[model samples]
Target: MSARPSPIFRNVSSKVGIIAAFTALNLATDYMLTGLPNVKFMDAFYFIATFEFGLSVGLPVVCFTRTAYAIVNPLGAAPGFLIVFLVVGDSMYVLSGYLSRTFRLVEKESSAGDRVLSIGLIGLFSALGFDLITNFGTGLSMVGGSGLQSHLWGALVFGLITMNFPLPLGIVHEASDFLFFSTLVPSSLALLSRSGLITTGPLGRVIGKRGDNQN
Candidate 1:
């Protein structure tokens, strides 16, 4: 007789443990980087989460994490800020993941020249989308309607430079994150593939652009 699957697997205990560990790592990294004044650790963690888990998983995680962080920190200001931050930032992260997946799929099927263009378009749109949503929410909360234009412009410029561009440091950070967690949570990765959260199709192949075309 074939052996039954382990009961432990039914609870998703291992997957939850891995996510929690990674969440802690993300928080630690944010704390360490918070001293930089310019670096936004939440944003970085948001990106990392989306890249690792995809939007379906990452966005809810981000929302809950941000809510928990706000409850702990309290910031000594309005409580509304916490809500705004969690909602806007989580939405932005989800949008980024969606755009990243879409553009990657497009690029995978395109010619070599289109790959570069696709990436550029994806980066530009992702950054712009993040900037618009984040700044709009921030301005609404902090400065009311009057501040929207200035805040939008400032955020657009900063996001374009810092997040959209293929900065060497950012690339290194993302690559490191991909490598580190992928190694540590190989089972999670396997589960994702099995669950179809990570697709195995023409889209997935094109997204990776491995040229194997076997999905």
Candidate 2:
């Protein structure tokens, strides 16, 4: 007899429902925080979803949530290139989340301070990487039709560092991500764990009472 398919793939509709729900939550937070220049909970949501449901669910959730937010943005729909850049940039969180789960980066047995630091560092690196990539994309878009071959690197640097000189948007974005990841992500995970939404499983390690060595 053939073995049964994994539970994750067994109920397609439930996964869809979960993805839709996360997308809605992300969009709602984005709308509510529209006034905040670079601060938003969408990234945190992506991380949280990945933490809870694993990468299989997190990937679609990030794509749908980001695309919908871009289309329904309060300012306006993003340009096609910008939309692509944003999606690619935001995917850092998804990758970090998956890595954290797979490798037990946030150890359940670790002290609170250590866990917080680990999570914060993850956020910091992910945010920095996201900014670097998207900024390069933006720079390329700006200079692509200008035939400025010699200025490509300068344009990329402009996007990353000196675009807004005094207080760069990238700085604010990175700071907010670090703060949110340090505080919000762990707190939410603990709440979910307590609520039994995140439990020990064979797919990978999770942030709960069990140690990695146990599994």
Candidate 3:
């Protein structure tokens, strides 16, 4: 009889494959939402993964998916040069998760309402921060050929432009993000629990459910 594969190897293989599939899903979804600009489910997925799998696994999904989406240029080439800032900014979601775990901010007894707001706030800040940092990069890239002082001034000018007309969109994105995280995280935890993808014995300390938490 063939021996069962080593647990470590199986774990690593499954994680790699899952990340790859997530990357593809991100690419496809971004392509589909190409024109919507601020509407996206990406942050929802980020929150769910972080809540369920913890930082080591979840952060990679955030970075890998964003990197792959940027490379695919589903929207256009305009964001190509700004991908670095995006990777950095978007990783804030993962950082929030790390902070939550480190502080035990969402302990097992915490109410569903509390977790929802916590995750929603993380999503909100992440979206807003990503917009700022990415636009700052855009300004710098725009002035690549200019002198240092000129580049700084140019960056400020572009920043102003972004803050004026595009600022409201930031709030819109955050609203959508908050909604996504507040709802999806709990719903996903419910499903994951049911499928035995994670068990109370192992992941309980991190992600558990009373079902009503989502309601």
Winning model by lDDT: 2
- Give the distance in Å from residue 125's predicted Cα in candidate 1 to where it truly belongs: 4.8
Candidates sorted by lDDT, best first: 2, 3, 1
Say which prediction, candidate 1 or candidate 2, comes out ahead on TM-score: 2
- List the global CA lDDT of all models: 0.47, 0.76, 0.66
Deviation (Å) of 137 in candidate 3: 0.8
Best by TM-score: 2
For candidate 2, lDDT tens digit of each residue in 18-109? Answer: 78888889988989999987887888888888867777778888788878888888888987888788888888999888878766778753
Could you estimate the TM-score for every candidate?
A: 0.48, 0.81, 0.75
RMSD of each: 11.1, 6.8, 8.6
Candidate 2 vs candidate 3: which has greater TM-score?
2
- Which 10 residues in a row give candidate 2 its minimum summed lDDT? 1-10
Model 2 segments beyond 4 Å from truth?
1-10, 144-152, 162-166, 198-215
Once fitted onto the true fold, the runs of candidate 3 whose alpha carbons sit more than 4 angstroms away are 1-10, 108-110, 143-157, 160-167, 200-215
Candidate 3 is scored at a TM of 0.75
- Cα deviation of 84, candidate 3, in Å: 0.8
Candidate 2 residue 33 Cα shift, in angstroms, is 0.5
TM-score of structure candidate 2: 0.81
